[model samples]
Target: MSKKLTIGLFGYGVVGTGLYDVLHKSKTVDATIKKIVVKNKDKKRNISPEHFHYDKNEILNDDEINVVVELIDDADAAYEIVTTALKKGKAVVSANKKLIAEHFEELYELQKKYNVPFLYEAAVCGSIPIIRNLEEYYNNDFLQSIQGIVNGSTNYILTKTFQDNLSFDEALKEAQEKGYAESNPILDTGGFDARSKLQILLAHSFGIKTVPEDVFNVGIQNLGDLEIKYAKEKNLQIKLLAYAQKRNEEEVAALVIPKFVKSTDTFSTVNDVFNGVKVQTAFADKQFFYGRGAGSLPTASAVLSDISALAYDYKYEYKKIENSENLKLTEDFNLKVLFRHPSKDADKFQPYFENIEEYYGNKEQGYFVGDISFKNLKEIFSQNSEEVSFVLIEVLH
Candidate 1:
């Protein structure tokens, strides 16, 4: 682990290019790039052609390459590359959240079996070092809850929609144009991306391993004028929040949904492409972590930090996971929610949610504020997804 790192980098996309630039400019890390794997050899890149390779074996088979950095977009392909790299006894670094989150257990097993370091600090919150803090800093503390706006693209879109007076579509278009969002932005807007990240965090934050599907998630895609108007009237802002809290002594509840945040709340000030994480612990109280959540350089910086840590023989020990024999992931909790829809569909929902706390509307449109169990929330969302806008009402004690 002390020898100079010979890196085999995969995918010369945005993050890849940024990593190359940062590595070359960095004088502290004693690492050199041996080869970079790209899908299309025909695509013109600024780097020398000799550094790029289309075949994965060229790096996988190279005994000189000691580190493998995987930054690809495809989860399947990234999985193949990472497994091959780890099996070859090479330390691995990756920033693919979807790949890492979906295959976390398998990858953890691989790292243990092969006895190699596999670090992915950029997978969760871009430049924020929440993963490292969760592993090293909060190792002994009891966590009560972890919540924040983990998705930057949605935050940017929401900021524009609220502050800039732009529609959701317009804000999304701007984000895509600025490289803040993907070409197919469903993963970001649909809450799937945040859910994947939350899946990874739950393991570190609460020692709970759960699939992304198991976590109840509702995105900002269904957001419209009705929800925005209501929030403005209430002097609140809407943020797509990822939440994981201790429901009791043994179970932890997790969800990714839009929540109504008051202007005085700390999360309300976390806008645009910046990411914010609020961790509530037993002894430390509340701690805040904030940084750029998107863009090439910010993410690449995190990747670089992991690469640097490799020089010191640093790898996540996953202390919380080893001690989590009784902890479990659960959804047995009630959430205060605001449901807005057209007046015509009122009956479609009222029969389901009998415990309505408040109701207001006319012939054209209407809404209700009440509490719903996680089970019923999922059922209602599945049936009336297009007709309703559901938002979590953040009630302070």
Candidate 2:
């Protein structure tokens, strides 16, 4: 019989409760979920357990609990929970991507120092086990590229734009209604959510660290309807990709953007809110992992995997931290365009002028409307100019 590893669940939300239920449901339970800790000082819930505690201090002091399952996803609070757990020599399993991306290096170091495992299988592509696969098998393989529909919200939006002929706005609104997107959907659609996951992916795959801001990211916000329309005609699809690959020797890169994927590719066929991750490992060749990618139970399943692994490592006293840099492999570049918000707005615009002859008659770049609110002809404008592109307008006579 496996030693019963005790767990203290830190969130009573969907994933948290779902994990608790899953623990009970699995007959071959290797770990015992002994207690639950939540931050409802005055509120009541359907949660049972007279052992429940509202105070974090009280919760962390419990000696019986040797593992923590962190589903309370706020970055700041999660740092506290994880740190306290590590300090107490308790292992952790977290589904909070934001917290993990921000605190991974610190957490990894802490885990290494304390000789405890920090498992976060639920953070990126949920239940895929892609991270474990990459860390274990592909470390010695030369990786050419990583392309994926890592975010379900943008996938749903783009898929709608293709299949239902719905506008981006329309699709986004529908997604919002379906609970597929949050009220503040910027994180999902605007590429930050995927970028956060990209950091996690890159850290494990490349043994490198990146801040979310470091990823070369461009959201699907500015994609005009015409491009979406054109891509469909060409039998291609647009997927907001979370990419992390090697750019050069000793240099790694990451990107988050809407990219043109050919229709012939299986990734293009993967539509309507499903997520897929394509791997370009030398030995494995072209392999993909696809699924719901985001949800309560699906995410909980990955968390349970982490719980299982963390429990296994704790029970057997396994060497949980395995560094992958000792192997020989070439890192591939992640090609992409980047975006930066304006430092200065309406008062004084820094103009950016382009030599239109560069693009010539490239309709893919823009069109020659011959109307000049926006540049109809990209002439030899000064390279020092600020605003190169503007909205085209016409005057009524």
Candidate 3:
């Protein structure tokens, strides 16, 4: 018989409340919530006041609480809570991607020093279970690449633009209204959210230690209707893609950028608050995992999966971390780039490409296709930042 797992849950927000409800309903795991920690003690809540506590010690100091499930939004505070719990000899589970990715090495050390389990499955791809699959199923295989539309807010906005013909602002407003995006959705729209997820995946898949700042990421904020129309005319769809591929054993290429994917590709079909991650490997070839990338219940389900695993004394070995021998990351591969800008700046930007062709044009608005190295493309974009309005890299199958 399995032992009953006692939980001290932090942050009674969306995911936290959902986790509480799930634990109450689930019988498969013998777990009980001993206490819940929240910041706003005055916030109105339907749950009983007796179950809520504002102080960290209410959960961290409780000897009966064997597990700490953190569902907070502040990465720095979450890091403090997680490390404190780990030092106190409690198994930890979190859904904070930013915290995990930024402090991975420190957290790993704390887990080892304290001899406790720290699992974070909900941090990436929501309920897709990609972390467990990478940790167990694909651990032995030679993973070639990981490509996906990992952000649902961006996906939903893009879907509205493509299907409803809404402007980017209109689509983003709709996403915010529907609770798909935050009021300050810069992280989602700017590709930082997806970049954080990619960093976590890189550590799990390739044993590389890196941060979002080091990645070559471009968001969909600058995409225009003209670029979308151009892609559709060419039987392609534009998607904000998070991609990581092994260029060689010593180096990996990773980036988050807008790509002109073929209409028939699985990525093009993953639309509207949904996410799909395609894992390419030596043995499995290409395997796709699809599910709701966000929301209270979906994310809660992933957190519970970690809790259930911890109930059985499961912890990530992170074997890839030890096996990797100083593998470097780069974004210098070749790419076919599509650029849209004002005709006045054409002379300045067009010369950077190796081979160039005009796709569509007018006296005011014009677009061109060109072949260039990804490094040079980024440099050109930085140099001519204001002139270029849209850029999309051609997806290589």
Candidate 4:
């Protein structure tokens, strides 16, 4: 260990800057940033050679740099950068879930080929340390269950709905306005982010790789304020959950979707922009990791932890991707149930329909509250030829 460890960063966005600050200021004597690679930008402002660069080639080619840290979010570019760095026999660390989820096996082959580390600690759960937990402890035990409100955006939105009685649109607006969620939110609100984390954890805990699309995934788009109302009445909460379990030692349960949680549960208490993961295992019993799931500093803190550990002991850092088998996603993973039914204590809220004399009902007939099966609902609506024209679906308390 030296006073400083030379490193190269591919992105200068939020996580990149935070990584610079942490490594440069950490109390650790041996860990430090050597050079932060960047694309060509304004040169009028003063910048340190150790602070910036203009090309991916510059970072990849440098011999002084020992560790290649990638914060760039793109999956393809990250693949090229990481593979190239590993080919050159340099350590690589990244926070890209898409890349990790898509190319874990390929990346690890290169890692083991050169005996260099390929680390991705911040790829999941920000600073919660779930990946490491699964890799180290849970793997030893029989991890029967893994269920959590894994996405902060959806969790925050649901929390706001519970507290302020905000509509789906209203809560989503607040999330976007506060920068808690993306404008599209298809990824977070859709539960893809949690699925990525679940894939990585599943690989370690189960000794296999699972594709993003392979794991069962259902987003929060269909769920509305009515379910929130029902959850509240039953002393339950609405949350987007990323879950997996070993059903019979030979079977496994992994899916992402909205769930109604009982008030007595720890998950219901976890609210308002906070994230938590609950793991049920034989030895550890039940453990929960809760915090701000994402942000520059929180994610950076996880990255720095990886950097320090990789710097200290690169020997224990074997590539799991190479040894593990890919858990191919089934074409039809539709189990009868995605998760356990809502607790009996929780309100089973459904939308109600009332016929308000609509001038003989022409084209607008039924409201859609996501609870009903869309296939059946569509069939039912299609048969109404009597100028069907009135549909209204909302929370039926």
Worst 10 residues of 3 by lDDT: 388-397
Q: Which stretches of candidate 4 lie over 4 Å from their true place?
A: 1-4, 40-50, 315-397
Q: What is residue 75's positional error in candidate 4, in angstroms?
A: 2.1
- What RMSD, rounded to one decimal, does every model reach? 1.6, 7.8, 1.6, 7.7
Error of 2 at 372 (Å): 24
For residue 273, model 3's alpha carbon misses the true position, in angstroms, by 0.6
Query: Once all C-alphas are superposed, what RMSD does model 4 give against the true structure?
Result: 7.7
Which portions of model 1 miss their true places by more than 4 Å?
none
Q: List, residue by residue over 13-88, the lDDT tens digit for candidate 1.
A: 8899999899989999989988898999789898778888899999899999999999998999999999999999
Tell me the deviation in Å of residue 136 in model 1: 0.3
- Candidate 2's error at 239, in angstroms? 0.4
Flag the better candidate by lDDT, 1 or 4: 1
In candidate 3, which residue ranges exceed 4 Å CA deviation?
A: none
Prediction 1 global C-alpha lDDT = 0.87
- lDDT by residue (tens digit), candidate 4, 1-397: 5334577888877788788777768877376566666665763323454467777888788898888899986789888999999999888888998888888768756766788888787887787887777666664576767777767888888888888888878889999999888878888877788788777777666655655656756677555434454457667667777777665545565667566676677887888877788898877789888877888889999889888767674432433334434433232222221111223311221221122221111132222223333233233335532222222222211
Question: Which model is ahead, 2 or 3, in terms of lDDT?
Answer: 3
Candidate 2 lDDT, 1-397, residue by residue in tens: 3557888888887788778778878776588877777877566666655757777766578899888888885879988998889878988888788987877768777876888878887888776777777676676777756767888888888889888988988999999999888888888877888888887777767776656655655567555555665567767777888765555545554666566677677888778778888888667688888887877788888888777776457321112224434322222321221112122332222222211111112333342222121221122113312433322111100
